[model samples]
Target: MDLIDFSAIATEHATRLKAIDPLLPPPGELPDDQGVLTAEASGSAALGVLSCEKTPADAPGAQWRALVEHRLDLRLAGPDPGTALGLLLEKWQERLAESGTERGDWETAAVVIRPSRDSTGSGELLRHGFAPVRVVAVRPAERHGRGPRRTPGVAVRTATRKDVGNVVELLLELQHYDAQFGVATVRESTERALTAEVEEVLAKDEPLLWIAEVYGKALGVARVQLPPASDWSKIYVDQSGRPKLGYLTSLNVAEQARGTGVGTALAEHAHQVFDTEGVDLALLHHALANPRSTPFWYAQGYRPLWTYWYRRPAVR
Candidate 1:
């Protein structure tokens, strides 16, 4: 494909996406929207486009402290999707090598793939050392009834400043559980940082912090952010044109509280809050490798919208 043709294709892709959802954020103009690289084939043609952007070291909650992020969008038009993907991967590796001072110097690389209907490039991604790290799961905001019925002893209520310490502890416990799946590490600073975050949330009236208690002792915590008029709110709306959006940022239950219906109660309560606030959709992300979270969220009716594939080369 020539430069002009490639640019038109990229623009068309973005336009189609926006048309699907007018609120969708614009896919920023790529630096190399004009074809920087092309693939030769045995019988057909393929095109590969790569875009790089610098990611700040202190970007909040980033998985890695990478200096740059490379995004690869591969389009193949041939009978052999596998071969075309292989060619794209080869070109991607060459670009990475040329851009970095040495192999594995870059902190992180990623690609976004839709795996709902097809598995076209999944194998190629795995073969090239990418692992699925985060899955964006979403569900319509229809009421799932008030709260967990089975757990009669558990009570859910809005958290207060006095509950900050307990909430922080529950969050740390969650981090420890997440660490088992290699999603996060519980550092010494984690507690202090989390404490501050909880305190701040408690101070805010918009994003709610809820606690699940049994006999007046906190055993679970859930944080839900009401949609603000900004980018984060628009990202998770249901295609059915939800008037409002709600994000279930974090839900953590104490180890002993698992399987006892505490999590269900907490989640249902959050949903009730969303329903009361006129939210028509809810969104959350969980590590694909988290065995407990994976099933629990699916049971709650959340399905994956996008899967984030991550690659971090081992540094010296």
Candidate 2:
């Protein structure tokens, strides 16, 4: 609020941004046009920092970083005697001050920051002092065509529960290539997640675990993850105090199904369904390291939403 606080706020924002930048969105041309930007970073640093006695989270790394994805909205207000682009430098010092006070608190962090461009309200406050609070989800723009997928008959549908096993196997296959995109969710035979993952998928009315039939046999599997309702709920609130959309989470298709339109079909179909269900936004995360996933989503009309970053304070 004062001259002293911008550094603190900016520090927090930058710290939060850097910490979460790796896991959230790919940083490209900042989304100044649509009022959004995205960056990515590993959640590992955030994981170590957020490990505290309070703010009890069970699956600490996954759950806590996910919170950053949807719930990272922070704002700092201070004096803004606007010039050209340099107004931001003053804001950083103030923000840094504020964050310094809370250094030992709860492993606190933020990422995938969203900012608003309220240009209609013309004034110094609107122009000078008005730095946006960080928000979580900034989705891609309207997309009719995205990644390529298997053609219609190329993808066969699963007929029965017996098909689920083969589908799960194919899913495991894709996970090997997932590391190309910075995901390290490799299944351990020592720590078998197959049974648990399968059960969770089957329980969903919108089961992400799907079998793609080829040559009269199930050769591939793909799945979609619906982000928790809360992920969208925080962003979907209206002036009238009502929530609008539910969010989309992770989606994966088997290697065999890759160029045949399986991923593209699933994504397009999901988009149509979301539109029909009155959900206005569809969001997802992909690896920056993977050239295909990022370009693939970009082709689908998803624009840069926000950027996240990650690094340990010790490392910095």
Candidate 3:
């Protein structure tokens, strides 16, 4: 159908969704040139699904070798949009099968949706072979003017260019650990890519890098972006112009220091900083299956906002 009709369906969906969860961000405007598949079930308000693909090169971590992603942006409307969702997924699955995959063996089909919609569409997602892999979690900025809790001997400080080597080492440690859960991959160029990104952040006039140290030894890191710096992430978790957003880019604690409160201290420090800077909300993405991080973040007051469902290899 035309873009006008598609947008109307999406608008209707958004109207109903707000009543369900006011924090859920409105979907971004549909791309002018992308084609959308529409499904109209017997008693539904019609569902529109936009198909988009991302080559590894489109993102920094592309050099990681084993990552290819295909996405479906669903505009789900009506009282029972799940039925239409099932139909659209079925057709999309067929489209993938007929395309004949020469896309190597490292591809995944993904869909990201609000966590509140789980009951409505999750069953259909699972039936179509998709499983939750990652989540975009959120936290509000609130500490009642109190400072971050202190970890006995640990000190948190801003990182500078001189600390590049240590920062990269700690981040690499994080990537390798996440790789075990298939959330990340370590490739020949991984270090090179990471170094460039880390250096760029450190070079920023107001770099949001923090290092946790205990007696002159660095044991943890928290990378964050505040205000204008975090604007880019709005495409992932748009707050509908309601609040200023802050992003927790990455947080890593040395394996040896995992349970020693270093990570908590780092997180609280970041939250305090965000609150001080007047950031209204904080967002981050983490692996759903990570035994350690999943629980750690929940304890830090972040809960899942968007769940990314995936079917790996992207083949029928």
Rank candidates by lDDT, best first: 3, 1, 2
Q: What is the lDDT of candidate 1?
A: 0.66
> What lDDT score is found at residue 135 in candidate 2?
25
> Which lDDT values do the candidates have, in the order given?
0.66, 0.40, 0.75
lDDT per residue, candidate 3, 114-171, as tens digits? 5544457788888988878788888877623222345589999999999999899999
User: What TM-score does prediction 2 earn?
Assistant: 0.53
How many residue pairs clash in each candidate at the backbone level? 0, 50, 0
Between candidates 2 and 3, the one scoring higher on lDDT is 3
Q: Give RMSD (Å) of candidate 3 vs. truth.
A: 3.5
Better of 1 and 3 by lDDT: 3
- Which residue pairs overlap in candidate 1's backbone? none
TM-score winner among the candidates?
3
Ranking 1 against 3 by TM-score, winner: 3
Q: Lowest-lDDT window of 10 residues in candidate 3?
A: 142-151
